[model samples]
Target: MTVYKQLLSLPENFSFRINLDYLKSTEDGLFRTDQESITRFIVLDGNLFFIKIYVSNNNRLVIETEDVSQSYTKQFERQIMLYIRDWFDLDIHLEPFYTIAKQDEYLKMPISKFYGLRNIGIPDIFEAFVWAILGQQINLSFASTLKDRFIKNYGKRLIHNGEDYWLFPSPRLIASLSMDELFKIGMSRRKCEYIRGIARLIANNQISREKLVQLSDINLAVKQLTAIKGIGPWTANYVLLRCVRYPNAFPINDVGLHNALKLAGSLDRKPSIDEIKQIASAWEGYESYATFFLWRLVY
Candidate 1:
């Protein structure tokens, strides 16, 4: 195997510790991290590569690959850079968000406590969609368990140094599966159908990340995503926030969001949808960040 190394500069005020904390909370079996480095597998151009990323003393990211081939073409480099940028939300400047957050009573302390935290995102649209669907109506812990089982059952794996690195199952692979095959992994029938339905759409090229990005309008994109089976308002907004990187894509109906807000406000009851809307209005374009920080408080 050929070794490849690259260094990428991080944005000012980027907190590797906070981002690692968020990643650690996911309990995803597909990736692993230690105090020094994060390791995951990524598929590019039909090739699987294991990448290990660490923060250097100079405050830049050091990415090393376990592939032996000279695959670092211009396009490959660009893809990796974009993936890293999206994963860390390096493009978003949070100073303005901090300015607004400090003025708001509910968000002030949490924001200060979790300073430099970004909305750690899922860069793959298909992965984001399937994850959001799997999480519906279930507690996060169970959802994570389901995710682990699903990946182990369907995802491709690469073994290195006596460890396994898994790639998220592709749309083509899932689209070819039957309900029984999926159900064996503990997926409900409806969810099985939903995953297959969306997978088929993606495999057939009827929908794609490129197509959605061209839409530009968040509302229209959400509408189109919601039109697919198993994608509701919450899932659509979750995709927008995590995959599309839309700053204002807030899932107001999320139980975690409501519970976080309830705890933050010390309310006797969870706030109603109407109350959530009113309370969230203060954050405006930064609603996703506010929701993410609030989620950290409870989760």
Candidate 2:
């Protein structure tokens, strides 16, 4: 019944490139299918700008702009699309698996269907870190409930056309909040300290998005992130996948992934970490893509 507009330019295959499918699985807030979230009812223009969208259950959004200059529209649409997708993670590229992926029956189905599924990408560096941490040892539903409360208490929001859209909290905002504040939302003391420590690092520029990207060696980034109190291999790998666009990144110990693999391949039991590594070996440089494909099997 109403419309809101943002000049979003979507790059070609930006949806596929950014691993939108991956983000949808990992990032709890961004890609919601529930009636309250409008992320699923999305469409794109030639330049990949989110020129039109309609959330089916609660309401509808119609683009009402009359500035219909095709040339200008296309150009600006491209810019806007790219910005939103990158901001929300819609154009990240993961290396391909080549022959190994082609040879694997498990991968063939997913590889073919990947572009059709929503690729997941996380744009917020700090939020990604926090999410990776929060999800460390919990079930997805519980993690989401915690995230809902966490964001509602700490995140900033914008009211557009009487609709509320939330922006994940910034480091500075989070750093200023007391641990007791976060704890009130069901976070354990250890998780609170972990979040605060990460915020302090980001606030002081001791660690930065740019710094992570600048490091060509993924090992170094993982090491640096692990140095933070509660961050470990899974968190670091999750951050790498969502924030830095690292292709080979996969949270090996993840229960969802472990189970998804077993189900996808029709195995009776979960694969050991070493077996998981070997199974993923053929996928090689595209472990992230393979991971994304496998993760899809469960959802």
- Could you estimate the TM-score for every candidate? 0.95, 0.75
What lDDT does each candidate get?
Answer: 0.84, 0.65
> How large is the C-alpha RMSD of every model relative to the true structure?
1.5, 6.9
lDDT, residue 260, candidate 1: 86
Query: Where is model 1 more than 4 Å wrong at Cα?
Result: 68-70
| Regions more than 4 Å wrong, model 2 | 1-81, 85-95, 98-102, 117-119
Which 10 consecutive residues of model 2 have the lowest summed lDDT? 41-50
lDDT of 2 by residue, 1-299 (tens): 32335433443333332243344455444333332233421223422111333223222222222232233455554554464555445355433453455568667666565643333556568878888778878877887888888877787554434545455777898888898888998878999999988998898999877888899888888888888889999999888886777777878888878887887678899989999888887776667767766777775
Q: lDDT of model 1 at residue 130? A: 88
